[model samples]
Target chain A: MDFALEVNKLCKAYKDTAFKLQNVSFNIPKGSIVGFVGKNGAGKSTTINAVLNILHKDSGEVAFFGKAMTDDAKYIRNDIGVVFDTVHFSGELTPKKLERVMKDIYENWDGALFLAYLERFHIPADKKIKTFSRGMTMKLSISSALSHKAKLLILDEATAGLDPVVREEILDLLLEFVENEENSILMSSHISSDLEKVADYIIFIDNGKIILSEKKDTLIYEYGIARMKQSDFDTLDKSEYLSARKRGLQLEVLIENKKQFTRAHPDIVTDNATIDEILPMLTKEESK
Target chain B: MKGLIRNDFYNVEGSMKLTMLAFIIIMIVLGIAGIYFPPNSYLASAVIGGTLGAFGALSGTAMQKDGASKWSRFELTMPISRSDVMKARYISFILYILIGLVMAIISALYFMR
Candidate 1:
């Protein structure tokens, strides 16, 4: 498979501070929405910055479309479109004026498309961006990013503050982009539901290490929250499981292998896993 | 990169135009004030440039705040490179600064001459 973004042993640190990423490696196949998930300060932002060359990594490799991401990166950038949590449009200009400015910057910039998005998203072209609400500004940001026909879309907390309706719409639009099979997305968001909806793959990180990275559906099925009797838990092997929590004499186990464990211990009741459940269980206290 | 520059340019929105207009108005006001209550041309020029320069100097720095924000991660997902985003911003800054400088020069030259 042609990988859209390849990260290998990517590492970075802030002077004397703890390492931001530790030997993190993953491959995002072309035309895939890889959900980059981790809690706040889990180095999700740091990893994305290293991919974009925004911050210099202490050690590692990031490649986009098979091209090495380097500090001297130039032409490779035009292929990506970024939409962040905040749209910092200069308070000095209007979107109308920006259209003119952007046309010169993007070789494939589509004016008609940008204006169409503005209209669709209800963003006023002549109004000052400072007057826009958070949602409006984010729409404007996404409009500009999409209008340029970039091959990859990178989002960091872009939907954090957006209402669920708007967030879903944005996610739908991203799915539309990747439907063509040439476009891919590496969306970093704390809003797990958004990623759960559209992402094909997921990489969970905590304290600078990749705790779990797998196909979304596979993860949801493989890692299960198992509810069992207090007596049932006494004989189960702890090696293949993530954790166990006791509630009112009932025990719940988060295991990596549900079918095999179930086969061996047929009486143990298993519950379905969710994208949300996998992260905490897999990385919970670095489950032994 | 052009798209990003344009996006970032638009993203920062009203502050740029409002600030530019405010600068031009101040320069013109000072220019006209000098004509009636005439001060030294050099001092008048100094006052006009100084006020406008205060905001102008902040253009580069203001945009960098986003780079240090959550949006910096958003920017990475796009096909654009980091340096290109910065370059587009740098160009936009130069363009706006030039526009402001010209407006001041034209206003000052009109009165000083």
Candidate 2:
């Protein structure tokens, strides 16, 4: 398949423990928003860092724009815009100073656009960054990232913990980026709600292993959560189930092919499960 | 590269103001308290060097802080090279150092007069 970014057989470990990212493999289609879903310490940040060459992967083949990332990481980086959850600027520097620094660094930095974003975000052009609030800091980083006209944006939990309004604004911006159909985004976020709004594809990882990767719409349609009696679940074919668990008097089952399963078993009431419900079951079943 | 350096230069917080002030005050104290002689090239050179060190330190710390910030991760994802990002902060430091030295030069000239 033609991919915008590919992580093939990627592996990494931190602090001499088990793998931080064990055999992670997935492809991000060009111009699509790929959501990276994982809990804390699930190797989401580590995966992003490896792609950016911030932390070296133990072994893997990463290709971007159909070129080997290891061989041409620097070249690939020029086209990727990265956004993280924390502020990256120094407390002392003003936006004006940061612009000057970035202009010299990025070959394609746009000073006018950066200034416009700062103004739109209501970030004071001359105020010290130390005084800026968390939301302001995030906005500042985004303004800087977008000004360079990046084709790929890698956002690591960029919207986590943000207010709904702020998160909505960011999601709109991400959607705007994807509207070009020449830009792709790989955003790693714990809040699946954020991704649900913007992601075209979803990759669910847990405890260093990737569990599921599929188009968001396909996942929503193909996989359904059914609450059935425990005895009823036993009567159904086990192969049709992605996962099943009993809680009190309720039995929840994640079906592999919800439409087909629904046709086969008309008696069962099938309902769509959110990404949050899908993740824990997928990861737990995979781990088991 | 050039843009990053420029950003660091005009930032104007501790790098430009506080550190510069501290450097100048220390230089003046050293010149007046113990070295009670008429100001000369030696005084100018010492003050400039001190001012450079002070501002240089501020910018250096700022660069490291930048590395840890959200911008660091964001910029890293872009096509720009990490080396370029790292280089921007250093160039910014050099700019701050020069700004401090300029102030020191003016102070030394005033003392000589």
Candidate with best TM-score: 2
Worst 10 residues of 1 chain B by lDDT: B69-78
Give me the runs in candidate 1 sitting further than 4 Å from their true place: A246-249, A286-288, B1-113
- Per-residue lDDT of A1-288 in model 2, one digit per residue for the tens? 357788898888887776678889988888799999987888899888887677888898888788877523665666667777887776777888778767766667899999998887899998888889888888888888788778788888888778888778878888988898778899998888888878899998888888888889887777899888867887887788888776688788888688898888889888997899898777665211
For model 1, what is the alpha-carbon lDDT of residue A17? 81
Fnat of candidate 2 is: 0.73
lDDT of model number 1: 0.76
For B1-113, candidate 2 gives per-residue lDDT tens digits of 55555544544454456675676677668667545665567756776777667766767666566655545555555455667766776677667667767776776665666
lDDT of each: 0.76, 0.77
TM-score of each model, paired residue for residue: 0.81, 0.84
